[model samples]
Target: MAVGGLDLAKYCSSYDFNSNDVKSCSRAVDLTEACNWQKQRDDLEGVYKSADLHSGICLDPKGKDVGGIDDMLGFCRQKFKRTLDVRASDADGKDWRCVMDIDKDVVCIWQYSDKSLTAVQENGLWVCRRPADAASP
Candidate 1:
């Protein structure tokens, strides 16, 4: 499935992820698709719009980097759960809010609109800074 301008499975394979794990994440991504993959919308609607209403899931491989699409796909394959509304940030203090729970204590997907980057939170660290240079949050 594709979201945020990325084809989840394709991205993972392009990075040479494990075949089994890729399939796993593909399944997870499929589930997420059933519920509609994440999109940075301006409207604050639905349960996901509010972090308080969301829950989390467990991640596989225990401590994978989760800083890239491959790692995210690997993490998602283990469990498909809703993202928690954890207030996360980046080094520059940009609001990189947690958008999805790839896995527990593994990796979390974060969106920093103000910074124009989609970062990955691994053990509280933000990785994969993309869409560089933003003008708003």
Candidate 2:
């Protein structure tokens, strides 16, 4: 079967599923789709928005079901060694927060509006500064 532009038959050779090589085999399959990884990350970044419950925080607007916040956190952690303070609001407007030990060097935050989101690049950090107009929390 072909999935995600990869042919399973070609990538999956006959190997003992219980052997130590299983990880290697899985990695080989994962690497085959690595070319799309950057685009996927960028696409996710495009949809990221400020959490409704917090003034200076941002998160995946689509929430956990889509894994957007988790994926972006992983990317930020891996590439920049920084973390984001992510938050969410329940339907009734109660706030739930998730914070990581943000690097002191993180000088920018995500700026989101009703129609758009912008990530600013500063000192190798790719996130927006808190909007000047945002009310303090």
Q: Give all candidates' CA lDDT scores.
A: 0.28, 0.27
Q: Please provide TM-scores, in order, for all candidate models, with all chains considered together.
A: 0.17, 0.17
lDDT of 2 by residue, 58-79 (tens): 2233542232232433332333
Among all windows of 10 consecutive residues in model 2, the one with the lowest summed lDDT is 23-32
Per-residue lDDT of 28-126 in model 1, one digit per residue for the tens? 232222122232222222222223223222222443221212233333433333323222212223212222313211211322222344544456443
What residue runs in model 2 are displaced by over 4 Å at the alpha carbon? 1-45, 48-67, 81-137
Task: Tell me the number of clashing residue pairs for each predicted model.
Answer: 2, 1
Q: List the residue pairs that clash in candidate 2.
A: 109-128
Off by over 4 Å in 1: 1-3, 18-115, 119-137
With candidate 1 superimposed using the best TM-score fit, by how many Å does residue 89's alpha carbon deviate from the native?
Answer: 30
Q: What's the lDDT for residue 5 in model 1?
A: 31
